[model samples]
Target: MDIQVVHRPGNSAAKLTLDAGESVTAEAGAMIAMSADVGITTTTHKRGSGSLTKTVKRWFAGESLFLNHFESRRAGSEVWLGTPLPGDMTSMTLQRESLIVQGGSFVACESGVEVGVGWQGFRTLLSGESLFWVKLQGTGKVLLNSFGAIYEQPVDGELIVDTGHIVAFNETLQFTLTKAGGSWLHSILGGEGLVCKFRGKGTVWCQSNNQRSFGTALTPTLRARSR
Candidate 1:
């Protein structure tokens, strides 16, 4: 399947054109204009003013409905929407047949699909295993965005990632938040405090800039605020 990102970065509307039967998932309300024959479906959820209208238009045009809100379909493949890069959607995991989201909600392709919080809900229906899973249902390409440049680090054993710069990670890695440096006094005085310590074998994706601290440091009176 072929894919093209039509809109440039920072534009109000980012449009993706997919070949027939190719599918892509995106945040709930990002639809601008999709081809009628392309097939679009999502999990069930509440709709704001123009959401339903635009979705219906795409649906009637020949897009097949999958699970609502959480999943979608076109002809040959499916799309799983990632959290909005610039917005407040949280991280998620998909395991086996279930979709698991942390601090957010999910909709299924089939109607009346059970939706709930915590990891147990997904385990009960999909499998008994206690792991996070994110499934890319289709063969088509998908476009993802980030607030800044993303860097990949190959870890053979352990690595520490700054929480603010974390983009995503493989489910195989275990992590915990802890104080950086050797001692509390050092962390406080040196200005680098908490960090995420990751263990096990996997990859860590980090962004070039910290979304929170950078904004604060960028403002005027930066020297006074750093204290």
Candidate 2:
């Protein structure tokens, strides 16, 4: 399987070229186009599985309740996928590695990869986003989309990142949610909110823009709907 990301950094899409018998699983409604011969199956969990518990957890994480499995019947078959936001997409290969992805950032992954949910305890609830994270493991290629341009940050020790900007991080790193300023009052008054402090050595992927901040900025301009 070959994955190519096109229109990078803005309005990005992924074009996947698959050989015969190759399959990929993606979030529901992620498929934009695919070859006629490509077979598609929708399920509550990964292909050939009936795990309703996982599906419900994913829904709470802001992901689709179902997953779509695409299989190529013929060589050189192709499939295109896009995200709802206008931003960038990236592909990563996991060699028996584990990744903790921010909810809603997942796009697709090869069949060999396993997708599950990770509970980050009650602290994540204060991040102003979902408390659950999408966890990926196994050896395969994974695709992720972000609300803005994505960049990789190599953390040798510790790094502080706004919670809303993180796309994903290596499982080797431990993160804790904390106030951005020295005190809670300062954090609230300064408008910095909460931030995720990543510790240990690993890589952290972050989006250039924060969707929460963007939405907040637009709130004042958008007239409230009449009830």
Local accuracy by lDDT, each model: 0.41, 0.92
The reply for model 2, stretches above 4 Å from the true place, is 48-50
TM-score for candidate 1, please give it: 0.51
lDDT of 1 at 76: 34
- What is the clash count for each candidate, in the order shown? 21, 0
Tell me, by lDDT, which candidate is best: 2
* Model 1 weakest 10-residue run by lDDT: 102-111
**How displaced is residue 212 in candidate 1, in Å?**
0.3
TM-score of each: 0.51, 0.97
